[model samples]
Target: MGSELRQAFSVIRKAPELISPAAPTPKEFKKLSDIDDQEGLKFHVPSLFFYKNSPSPALEGKDPVKVIREALSKALVFYYPLAGRLREGDNRKLLVDCNGEGILFTEADANVKLEHFGDEIQVPCPYLDQLLYNVPGSDGTLGCPLLLIQVTRLLCGGFILGLRFIHTICDGFGFMQFLKAVEEMTNGANSPSLTPVWQREILNARDPPRITRIHHEFEPVKNSRDIFLNMNLDDMAHKSFYFGPKEIASLRHQLPFHLQNCSRFELITAWLWRCRTIALEPDPDEIVRLSFTASARGKHYNQLIPPGYYGNAFVYPALCSKADDLCRNPLEYAVELVKKAKAEINEEYVRSVADLMVIRGRPKYTSEGYFIVSDNTRTGFDEVDLGWGKPVFGGIAGALLIISFYLKYQKRDGEIGSMVPICLPLSTMEKFQEEMKKMTEAPM
Candidate 1:
């Protein structure tokens, strides 16, 4: 394909980094943003954006670094909530003190080019940990800025932006909404089309909070220090597969008559769940779970959650089946289960989850025999024209050791396509490939 792949990417942080607009020591709580009870979620969401060289104003004659820094500063004024610090509140829950402590903004230089990135999607994951900003040993809930950003210039004028936001501050939707605002500032727009929604009151647990509807999907978290602690961590491999319009259309046509018009995300997720469970080959009694996030903006719970409501408005809807049954079930059965999980995201479910979190009081989530899926197909990352035409690669850094990334394909070998990047143990990947072949090669 291109030049020989480099094993490790390199970077050097530019000097004199700024954590803008220093603040006075605060003991009193004048401004506080509370973290909602979402049953379970991590403390931080890490994302990456790799942009190719372009002739836009920000990348034109002026220095991109300086322009970005200035634009971010202006952006902070509008999105003032982001320039806060994570602190503990009542009940040991996390809350943001909107004290304007400012964001940790760093500039760096990379040794790779744009083409080196998109060509092999999964290959770049290991380097992502280096590219993103994470406090080495923080609980990810406290003592870290709500927002941390890194802009790295690459060998061929290409650059990558790293964004890590404390989850309590906002979910993926809110984060992208924030980026859209910053992009406007970079492009000299007066303001964003959607303003940040600050009313967390609607999402607060009921006054006499109780789980009105008992749903078995919300399982108590099983604490595990490391997801792959039992396996040799170093032996794991990250793999990616691309499926074009032809493949997606083919899969769609093969679905049950009732599911013919199912969303692409649901179709692919259902297919992935069946494939993964079969590949693992667990006992009949052993349970397997598929957990994916469902956004609550402009959709379910819309009456309670406004259009610009930029916070953790996502709930992880899960479905579990015996490993044996999951492996043997018709694809349509699993697909229907996925459809049911998607349908459970109404206003009652959202309110009940908040109440359940109150009861659980921050429980740990177990990853054993579980597959967490994230579909970035509509992330609007491709439209973030921050003075650049578009980013070559824009997606989340693998949040966990094992995750399935579903997003629109970035490369151009065929018609507009979709891609799935999954990281698994080497032994498991071998079996996974076998199952993938069996499913994809079967006649539609």
Candidate 2:
């Protein structure tokens, strides 16, 4: 009986670290070419936020070293593949690879203090205000020299864990999965339940693939027409806001022609398209697109991948409308355009996208006008149940204004979804809020 108990205890034993919590940057970084990845070239990384009370009730009494070490151990287990990237030949590819690593953690230097920006801080990036633009060198690695954990004197305490992962290895979903697994492992799980999908052949570029000419369909940036369509167009300022149950119910009643109310995702997307066109103030001849990703692991693509498999298991589906066409059209027409975009999600389209990337010889390209709408409501945010408690709140630390969409549940006043947190450009956020308020308050 005593031996058995000891064996059980061994499973959750704490891991020891030779390097202290406050180590400076590592000496060498791996290069991007070694990874042979297009995503390696793009260094935008996402941040995941969580709020929690410290393990000890006394906030100032808590040990930053202990907390950081525990977090590092958990990160090591969850991001084991990152260590593999460190071993790769090219330091350039390793630089952008989030998987490549020696763990770097920092606590507040004795002289430095944590500052609270309130709701304003909620919208801004926590470290250096760089947000996703913090670039890793040609190598896919970043130097995370410091980790500032706020020790609230009274009740307030917790951490905003930020990871600057190379976007090429995984997307937000994959990152969330990694975080969840780390939390689980810290609580004594041997291995993460997630079966990371690595079947590269399924999405491999076609051999001698015939590429399509439809790339020119997008709007080109002025002063740099040489850049592909929608690459670095004039910056359109926007703002961020969310829709809750109240606002959505109002929209159901406002629309004429027998409204077919859709899911929160479909409804919000349509509303965005409608409002965006209004903001564009565009020519009648140009086409504007509303785009979103379709999950690639459905019944049709089941043969291509298993359900738990992961990678970029998504394909972009776009809806095109003449700028004026969307503005003059009824709300239902916008809804239908989103529905049509949904239909474009298929195996063939996914394959074609892969083939196109390959045929183009995987050239480095940048674009700003493409809007990608993604819903993370289904992502296992709530699944991060550590022994202490579920996260009081969780979200993305910064909103990428250029071309990104992310949605998550909002918890407020002991209720979820007073409004779902939707991210958008700062310029358009107020209008979005007003629209949501009007829609939610409108009669059902």
Candidate 3:
């Protein structure tokens, strides 16, 4: 099936062009938050949303490319920073020039229909590159288009929107806000219901930066258990694991009554971290870390970061444990660690991370023995409506080598769950699947 899909799917794209704002916007430079310009967020992140043709009379005979292109131009008037070019100043601090340079846009036509993919589109999509072409020299962080979008029309009137945005510009929630703005324009709204805000200074470092908390996320490690460093890309495989109601029930059954009430994110992250560590077969005494980002927007610091502030406003909290202990302990052991790490992300924790970035020269998140899980199930990526009804499939186009995303999934029977995409070495993948099977197949 994979080979056939790969052979059958193809996209014929037009020359990419710039889409500027429909109206004039501010002509000035906007500084990025400390969390925005971090070394870990210096690259582009890709996401794709597939929309089946809507049956609504309002959307009938609508050209998605034309509607979206025009709507994007209008949306950029408020999100002008996205239409601008990124520039780096002294200290490697990043800022948007906000010069109305326009964002990269492309229109394409695909040979296949939505059904060609399958009932459910899985991650590590085979034709992601074809769907979203990476134009030469467009992925850099300095003086380049911050947002790149491609609209691919399918044979069955469905369309796929492919986006590649600079991570430094916005986090997942912020990006979704921008897309929602575009959706508002497509629906005939004059402007976004929520006004765009660029008060990035709210997340700036202190006058004299002071590290108030221990931030293990940025700690440098020597002689680390970095498995990916020695392995080539070809040796790894990506697969999506679905956790439906039954599977979740099975997993819950494995835990004690008290631990069974843990949130799905904690349960899944703990299980995957332990299973992944066992699969890698790292040294028993070696330290393994589980890293995840927690948003501070609506937390205790909600008053600090106002709504519509589209920038990086999250903290990377990491939990560490010995491989032997992590693999040998009960499921509750891992859950407790995850809960502890998540509970520590208060306002002070965020401030300390910002201070740490300045004090440590903006070090990247440590990758050694790291298993990162990002929960997108609640991000509302799937619910984005743009004239065409909600997308059939939405979220990250594929999985990264080190980071996995917990995406929303709904089965034909209407059972809703989470879909996690994981990439691992081929040999390790087999072992990982075995571990996962054991968890799901365990007796009630």
Give the winner by lDDT.
3
lDDT (tens digit, per residue) of candidate 3 on 1-444: 556877877899999999999999989988898878799888788988988878357768989999999999999999999999888888978888999999999999999888888854757677788889998889988889999899999999999999999889998999999999999999889999999899898888998999998877777565676879878899999899998788878878888888878988888899999999999999988888888879888857757788898898888788899899999998889999999888778998988888888888899988888878888898889998998998888888767888898889777677889989899999899999999999867897
Model 2: per-residue Cα lDDT over 1-444, one tens digit each? 334322332111122222231223333343322112443134544444444544533324444445445655555543444333333333222232333344433332211111232333232333323222232342243443212122121123444343455555555566666666656655556656775544445666567665443432233434331112333323433344656666566655556654555666777778776765564355655566666757776687756756444445665556677767787886778888787667656777766666666555454433433455666666655455443355444455444433444545553444444223344434555665565555655556
* Deviating ranges (above 4 Å) for candidate 3: none
Backbone clashes under 3 angstroms, per model = 0, 32, 0
* lDDT (C-alpha, whole model) for all candidates: 0.69, 0.48, 0.88
Q: Higher TM-score: candidate 1 or 3?
A: 3
lDDT of 1: 0.69
Judge candidate 3 against the unseen true structure and give its global Cα lDDT, from 0 to 1: 0.88
Candidate 1 per-residue lDDT, tens place, 1-444, comes to 233545556788754344653233333332232235332455566767777778485458655677677877777766776776666667866666667777777788877777776555433365675576454543365666677778888788877788777666777777888888888878887667787776776777777878876554456334412336577767786777666765677678667788898887887888888877776666667777788877666644556678787777766766887777888778888888889888766777777767777776754455667788887778776567778666666776653565666666555653566677777777777888887776567676
Error of 2 at 11 (Å): 36
Off by over 4 Å in 1: 1-9, 21-39, 57-59, 116-118, 121-126, 133-139, 220-232, 299-302
The Cα error of candidate 3 at residue 103, in Å, is 1.1
Collision pairs in model 3? none
Q: For model 3, what is the alpha-carbon lDDT of residue 67? A: 94
